[model samples]
Target: MPRVGGTKNVDVAAVIALRPDLVLANKEESSQRDVERLIEAGLPVFVSFPCTVEESLDYVETLARLLHVDAPPRPAPARRQGELRVCAPIWKDPWMTMDGRTYGSDLLSWLGADNVFSDRARRYPLAADVAGAPAADPGARDTRYPRVTAEEIRARGPALVLLPDEPYRFDETHLEEVRSWGVEAALVSGKDLFWYGVRTAGALERLDRALAPHR
Candidate 1:
């Protein structure tokens, strides 16, 4: 595979130069402008945006069909029963977490873990997401990942706080900080929590095991 560019700012010209059979992108990861540019340049682009584990499996099947390859076996549904209240922060500073509509949230849900911020929506104007500024109309903004305050997190009262090592690279220090909140916390693989497709099954197994002790 050749290096086209970063996820959010793909080099359209470079992609066009390669002239591949098909281009795969994620709606959230890749920029819409780049995808549009590729399409305008007569390149086939398939954009995926799966919000749940089941939808991700569907995306896998769709890709296999598009590439004329056999689809891999799907992972079994979560075997657990009860739900564990969890807060998996993707970033710090202002602190951000995924809502129920996001794939990461659904992934955690599959492992019998409920995201504490599932009902929260990202407020527009960014400032509104942090400082207590007024939020934009819901119809005008994307409302998936919400910026939250530490106080708000404490209010949610998550039983366990999962710290993924990506997007923000939560380390031992961050883990200790989260533990200081007086809740059970653990460091987890960011890819397992965020990435989908072929890794989904393995991610499910790994996360399931990781959450087992807490549950």
Candidate 2:
């Protein structure tokens, strides 16, 4: 089995000397160069890039499969995406680029919130351009833009703009700034859009109850 080191750099000399059957590593932490070095030293390695809670579940199954162990029970499908118009501005710069297997974009697509980009992985991108965050084809059939103003929040508009509290904490003052753009919006839990374990389906219930129209 592979080892989980508390630190970033590992003592490869000690690990390789043990002659383990298999090794696992995180993609972000265990760089390709590091794994390549291990392979050059004659160790078989598997890398994981689990960022969200769902990927954590998948990693468990992958580990079990590799170990010839029975997987945990299959869960019921997650709830349907709610019917609503949602404009999300949760862009991260340098493109954190959610894995296709991640949760955030999946939630948006599943909930029928009209996603903006389709760059393979269902992840939030760290977009450097503020314009990128607000961009969508004006003639696009399904997509809609939230009434927003880079100029000022008081001048902005949106039925419900979800300001996230992650990557950076968007507070009341920030909300007021966005509201100043002539849009009334709510601050949503970033984790809710991204993380889901046992509550994956239940979270949908909460979102519908909280966000959808009363009709």
Candidate 3:
């Protein structure tokens, strides 16, 4: 296994030099320009962007077919009886969280947790996401990750605030801060929450266990 480059800044020349059979990429993680470059170089590339747990499993099956490999059997997700109100913040500094449209939110939903901001969507002009700005038209912009405020989160009244360590690296310090908002908070693995494909089943199980006590 060789390192072509980071998600955003892939080394196109290095990848082309490898002369591999196929290049795998994620629409959200990898840069569009890089994927285009690989295609322009006559390299076969498979770009995936699954927005739900079911879709992720489908992606795994598709990838397996492309590579002539057997797709691992999907794991059974443990669903709880009652729903736990959850707000998972991916980033701070104008705090942002995933809405219902995202894979993360759907994953949580499958585990019997309700996303507090599931109906909220990101507003354009960035500043419009927070207070004191006019709302952006939902039809005109991407609205999966919405920027939120501490006050707004408090108002949503989530029973558990899940803080992931990627996209923003929320740690113990952040956990304490979130708890201060009058809610139970925990630091969970970002990869489990965001990463899809072969790990989807395990991620769901891990996250379900993490949210079990809260439920």
Candidate 4:
């Protein structure tokens, strides 16, 4: 069976054929229409919307209970006394970053890192538009992400720039580009920083190691 990418591209027929006992979904990762379609088909769907580290852990436990499995132990927080100012970009071309309200920012906070753009009004703000100016309505939900310019990032003067390999794959070239801004830069796993799962323990260790040099 082919794996459906997400809610927008979910294969309704395939899902129906599977005759699943329960369906797991995310409020942000899956669309309302898709969830409704599954419900209309008489399938059970559990939707999760976790915005912080603690909430995500709770979601994991909830999911485990639904599956009748033992939940993994909650990961201990990576300890650090002081904050490391960091800038993490999820996209480029127009440049986009996460702000205080996003899960990513919250995860960074848990890791003792502070997002340079955390104070922006939007959870995700465009590098070029910190004010989150109105955009032409596309009938789609406004992306929490916002666009920004490289110059704006330079002005923020982050102590470290974390380049993740997802949403937009930032590689060695991107690493160099960020370093050119006169700040230390490192490539990081986007899933490690942004994803919530049993692997959170590994993610925490990886982040601790990455930030160790900077602290």
Candidate achieving the largest TM-score: 1
Off-target runs (Cα >4 Å) in candidate 2 are 1-30, 38-45, 49-60, 67-70, 78-83, 91-102, 116-158, 196-210, 213-215
Global fold similarity of model 4 (TM-score) = 0.88
Residue 48 error, candidate 3, Å: 0.3
lDDT tens digits, residue span 51-87, model 3: 9988999999999999999888866665555678899
Candidate with more favorable, higher TM-score: 2 or 3: 3
Q: How well does each candidate superpose onto the true structure, as a TM-score?
A: 0.95, 0.53, 0.94, 0.88
Model 1 clash pairs are none
- Candidate 4, residues 1-62, lDDT tens digits: the string is 56866666888778877879998888877878888988999999999877777788888898
lDDT of 1 by residue, 27-132 (tens): 8888788889989999999999998898989999999999999988866776466779999898998799988899899988888898989998899877888778
Model 2, residue 21: distance off in Å is 7.6
Q: How much lDDT does candidate 1 score? A: 0.88
Question: TM-score of predicted model 2?
Answer: 0.53
All candidates in order of lDDT, best leading: 3, 1, 4, 2
* TM-score of candidate 3 against the unseen true structure: 0.94
In terms of lDDT, the poorest run of 10 residues in model 1 is 74-83
| Model 2: ten consecutive residues of lowest lDDT | 120-129
Clashing pairs in model 4? 124-146, 125-146, 126-146, 126-147, 126-148, 127-147, 127-148, 127-149, 128-147, 128-148
Clashes of each: 0, 19, 0, 10
**Would you list the rank order by TM-score, best first?**
1, 3, 4, 2
